[model samples]
Target: MKIALLQMTSGIDPDVNAATLETAIADAAGQGAAMLFTPEMSGLLDSNGARAATQVTDEVHDRVLARVRAAAAREGVWVHLGSLAVEGDEGDPRWANRAFVIDADGEIAARYDKVHLFDVDLPTGESWRESSRYVPGQDTALVNTPVGKLGLSICYDMRFPALFQALSGAGATILSVPAAFTVPTGQAHWHTLLRARAIENACWLVAAAQTGTHEDGRSTYGHSLVVDPWGKVVLDMETTAGLAVCEIDPAAVDDVRSRVPVIAHRRAIPVPA
Candidate 1:
């Protein structure tokens, strides 16, 4: 299947982001891309937590999501919208970091809420407390799509290997890691971590990233990558905001797994004395 990874620098405005997404979706589809993947917080990216909270809305009420769905239907292409910061359903005012898979018919096929929250103080003097603003999700999602079985995850989830292993075990051949990585962390760990996940899990790793600086005065690392099951970097968008399209062959997963067979090599460990 042909896939397009959309590297973007989204701002706090949902309307402008939606318009951008629609155009990319159309362009990708016109180029015969079967699916389009976007970065996390593609709908809204603002440095101020309070402003983001107020600007982002629930999934049903989010015009950004609605617009993407419409574009998906019109273009007849599958859309992995990466993730959207949305209001929590549990009466808590904090929003949820959620990723969605919309089918060509514009129906939401799968939804994965990001489990891991980023809360850290970087040496670059950048600090974030995501838990204070967004409620964490507890489940993992692997969706069946035309391209292949998709493993769903947002930005921070890339740091956790266990999640990718579990998704691969659950029959996911293509792992989607849509991210908005901070400059410091991205520069240090982005490629290495993504390659590790792909090699260890024996699955295709596709990460569409948020690039450049946003209206929030925050800059993100922009190196969107498409890794093969064998951990080879097939396509890389280096600090550019554009579409990176590549073909994904499902057979490659099986071929790599047969050669390495790490999953089958795993053994359950008993509690040690």
Candidate 2:
């Protein structure tokens, strides 16, 4: 299957972001891609809590998501809409960093709320408290798509190996890790971590990323990548805000797994007394 990844520099305005996504979706489909993957916060990327709160809304009311879904249906392609900041359920004041899988028919196939919250004090005098405004998800999400069974995860979730283990164990052949990562950490750990995950699970890993400085005054390490099951870097859109396409061979998963057989060799670790 052919898939397209959109590396973007999203701003504070949801409308502008939506238009960008619509255009990218059409372009991806025109290039004969079966699906398009977008970076994190595709709808809006704002660091200011006060300013972002004014634009954030529930999934049903998010114009960006609606536009993307419509575009998916119109283009006859699937879309992995990386993640969006959305209002949580009634009585829950906190919001959710959510990812959505929209089918070609414009219907939601699955949703995954980001489980790992980025609450850190970076050495660069930058700090984030994701838990302050969002509630972390408790469950993993896997859905069937044109490529294969995809495991859903956001930026911070990539650090947790147990999550990937669970997904791969549950028959996930492809993993989607959409992120907006800080320059400091991205430079240090991004490639190594993603490649390791794909190698460990013997699965295809697709990561769409945010690039360049945004209206929110934050810069991301953007090297949107696609790693095949054999740990080969098939595609890399290095630090550019645009769209790129790559072909994925589902048979690679089975071929790699058969060669390594790590999943079958995995043994449960007992808790120390």
Candidate 3:
């Protein structure tokens, strides 16, 4: 299947962001893309409370999600609407950071809320406390796509290898990681972490990313990539709002698993301090 990873620079306006998303999806569909993926915070990007203010609504009612659903139906393509800012329970209206799988009929197949909140201080004086603005999900989500079992995870979750191991153990053949990684952290650990996750899990890694700069002047590293089961980057996009397409044969998953067998070679012993 040909999958397209869309790298975009999202702003604070929902209408404008939706238009950009529509155009990008159309372009990818025009190129014969079977499934298209977008980045995190696909609708709006805000620094702090500004994001919290307007995130209070179901994504099914969100205008951007509506347009995305329409695009998927019109183009007869599957859309992985990466992560949208959603309102949660009574704690300052947290962001869900949700991902949706829209089928060809434009029906939502499954949704996954990001489990890990990005709460860290970067070395470049840029600090983010995602838990302060968003709620973390308690369940690990996996969706059966036309391709295979796709594991869903957002930006900060890439740092935790155990999540990928759990997904791989659950028969996930493809892993989707949508991120809005800060430029500093992305420059230091983005590519390496992604490759490491793919190598460790022996699954195809498809990551759509946020690129360039947002309205808040926060720069994101934009190297959207698709790593094969063998940990080779099949397609990569850098510093631009564009699409990276590649054909992923599901057979590669079995080949890699058989060669490595790391998942089954576990001794399950306690770690020595």
Report lDDT (CA) for all predictions.
Answer: 0.92, 0.96, 0.86
Q: Residue 115 of model 1: what lDDT?
A: 93
How much does each candidate deviate from the true structure in C-alpha RMSD? 1.0, 0.7, 1.6
Q: Which candidate is the best by TM-score?
A: 2
Question: 1-273 in candidate 3: lDDT tens per residue?
Answer: 788888999988888888988887888788888888899888887785765476447765788899999989988889999988877655555667788899988899988889989888877888899888788988888888877899999999999998999999998999999999988888899989999999998899999999997887888998998998899998889888877777889899999989998788756778999
Candidate 1 Cα errors over 4 Å, as ranges:
271-273
- Model 1 TM: 0.98
Please name the candidate that would achieve the greatest lDDT relative to the true structure. Answer: 2
Q: Can you list the residue pairs that collide in candidate 2?
A: none
> What would the per-residue lDDT of candidate 1 be over residues 185-238, giving only the tens digit for each residue?
998999999999999999999999999989999999999999999999999999
- Report RMSD for candidate 1: 1.0
Candidate 2 accuracy as TM-score: 0.99
For each candidate, give its TM-score against the true structure.
0.98, 0.99, 0.95
